[model samples]
Target: MEKPLLVTDFLDRARRYYGDREAIVATTGDRYTYDEFGARADGFAAALADRGIEKGDRVAVLDPNTHYHLEAAYGIMQLGAVHTPLNYRLVPDDFEYILEDAGVDAIYADYEHAEKIEAVRDEVPTETFVTNDTDAVDGDWESFDELVDTDETFERPKMDENDVITINYTSGTTGDPKGVCRTHRTETLHAYIVSLHQEIRDDDVYLWTLPMFHVNGWGHIFAVTGMGATHVCTRGVDAGGIFEAIRTEDVTYLCGAPTVLNMLVDYYERHDVATTGDRDVRIATAGSAPPEAVIRAVEDDFGWYLKHVYGATETGPLITTSDARRFFEDGSDARFAVKKRQGLGYLGTEVRVVDEDGTDVPEDDATLGEVVVRGNQVMDRYWNKPEATEEAFTDRIEGYYHTGDLATVDENGMIAIRDRKKDIIISGGENISSIELEDTLYEHDAVADVAVIPAPSSEWGETPKAFVVPTSGDPDEPGTDVDELVSFTRAHLATYKAVSKVEFVESLPTTATGKVQKYELRQREWDEEDRMIGEG
Candidate 1:
């Protein structure tokens, strides 16, 4: 008996097995059981069908983490339409490019962000505009609640596992964001992997700290729902709001980037709040290897376990997790050490750090190579970009997807990312990891946030430079001495790896997901130079 694998099965399972369970706690103070939530999804699906949204139609969803976003995702997929999630942080121009690029036919936007879509609605090919809050919206938009108020049932369309389920756009550091196409099989398999690795249980209560637009909340929407766990939705990530949700909902698990974790830690310290609660909360962090200092604070100060995972938009957005329970149980400093690395390849993923020739690098923990992966969870292709798709998979090893990240494999097969290929600083033939330098600087009490980039230097070709956001001082004026910060890094890292100069900035430019945009900084430094690659 062979049945097709589909992401919709997650919702179906919850509807059947956990109908009476509290399925969602929305920020609007609304609570719904699994039965009610499933019905809403069905109603939304029927409404889309009534509106002539057929199978394979590209439907974009633009919102922060909210109940409407979650229901819209399932409803869109139920109607066999492609779920295209838009980054809420992007501008109207960015939305215009994505809507045009994805050939989106319809959009379901949040009231907070409907104006961005409305501004470009005339330029794109989209014909239908739906919003969760029609009263707040000022354009020709359908009310999401009105549509879902019906008791109509939706017919399940025949779907194959290979059918494209969603189109996730990348952050587009250098150019317009690329649409990463994912299939039902890839998304479902990644959800199972996430469930197993994150230890998601039926009783688990998941807090929506990560944006649902990012890789479908890193596939937690399916993973948590499929496990019959409860979802606590927040409009956005705020320190006080997150703590209140965790305390009120008895949240068991959540995911976020390092920046979010840092914000939570700072809030906890300043307000003298406690992370302890009735249930133990586990957090999964990615978007960069969290500094060891941040990991320690998360575990020790916050009283929560931090699991550092790694992946990209093209790779199901989840490939590795640093559970490292065996090492952490030893009760030594090695516990934090293991949690800091990217850890081993995920259960069904095959990750390898390889050189230019596609040969695996030595597991000596020093050799840097591009990270390539071959797995069912990898995305199928880039939507409407054959040349880019070919370049992503064809140039690398026969069947593996090349991740632009550079990393080193240790003897234990643990993968530690050194830097992105472009972010690596080469000073006098020495390779320096900007991440390592930033991690060391994060340990400083005065440092609030930091980004390390290569600065053009006459003596060493290019040297590491730190962009510092001080905790309690004016960035424009003298607060934290640059010499003191440089000395701090030199004491922890090699002399050459230490930042040669420091630039005090109000804040680092980041993507919507809180990932620092190093390319912008690199462009400023190399605008007058002939090449971006540091002289060796």
Candidate 2:
């Protein structure tokens, strides 16, 4: 007999083989077995069916990292429903647009994010709302624990590799968020890529630092779960909390952005954390390329292995990795330097660097070009947006997913990102669009022209900072309120995307063609760093 090639099928096999093994370790010291996790998933599936959720339906989950959230994801996917996770930090307006745009049938929220969803409940098409926390929520909603008490066993829905398993919404670096539709084939293939580079093992204890909503937590939910590794869940990205989890849970592996890694390094240096159960821990970071200094600190100071990777929401989110070489032990700085560049494509992934003319650039590490990829793990399409999806796949490239990232490829085939072709601000791994922020800022009566860019932030890695050339009021007006402009924009846009700092400039530097030179603005802020994109 052959096995079904599906994400849910892998979960069932893990349960059958590693039934007694610990599946999840919560921050509050709660643990669940594979059997318990599987049963909870079954119960949740039955409850969703009871609520009239059918196959191919969309169920949005807005929560922090938790055991129940993981079960909710699996439970929804097992029944052939699309599991969509939302960023809890997004403001109500953002949530309102996404919930309605995605046509979510139901939402399973954490206690912290329940209020935001409640405020806009009537606008969205969501038919049901459930919470992991029971107290003080709406009367209509049901408790997560209560739903999991059902005795009904869920029969796995018959699904093919091409069936859409999840619809991950991008971080909205442009206008309205576009959903990246990924099938079971892509998810399963991405998991294999992660397992190969991340070196997944049955004994590895994985910690959840990255948000589950971010590329299916970098596709580790499938890879780690399939390998039967223990998942240690943390409520927030607290450096102390992470170290404590690593120590107590004996966590061997974790994934995060550069901001998360910097926070841990800073915390370790301040608190002087020596060891985790007499052994060092390992971490994987993505988003912006990490600085060589931070990479060295993770290896030398914190005694943790750090791997740099690059990907986007449309690219199955794991295209390349800068895995450390074993020869770095020979005290060669060159080996460490090579490991800093995002390494070549993972197995089954094809990557290329090409100029605007569609010509492949020489791998001299100086010829900059757009990075594109085609792989088994790449997304199938942008949901309901055929034109946008076609545009993304078209251009000079033939049968490739355009990444819209400007980068340089070295002779060794390692890729170093240079700039973004799109005006996207990546602060702490959250992708924010300059166009979106500028549009909101334009609503201000006092505003004239606005240009936004990624400004360096120690805490957030990069925050949105605005440069404004005021309207015809005054050249040097003392009464110009910057906070007032910021507040006005915050009212329209999400809180995370709001401008943290604003400067009144006489005029922005532009090219001869009359376009704002964002590169010049970014260069001024990031001049001191080795790379324009700060690793933090």
RMSD (CA, Å), each prediction: 10.6, 1.9
What stretches of model 1 exceed 4 Å from their correct place? 422-536
Q: Model 2, which residues run further than 4 Å from truth? A: 1-4, 324-327, 472-475, 510-514
Please provide, for model 1 over 156-211, each residue's C-alpha lDDT reduced to its tens digit, 9 standing for 90 to 100: 78999999989999765334578999999999999999999999999999999888
TM-score of each: 0.81, 0.95
Task: Pick out the ten consecutive residues of candidate 1 with the lowest summed lDDT.
Answer: 527-536
Q: Judged by TM-score, which candidate is best? A: 2
At residue 4, candidate 2 shows an lDDT of 49
* Predicted structure 1: lDDT: 0.84
Q: In order, what lDDT does every prediction score?
A: 0.84, 0.84
Q: Model 1 residue 339 lDDT?
A: 79
Task: Looking at model 2, report the run of 10 residues with the lowest lDDT sum.
Answer: 326-335
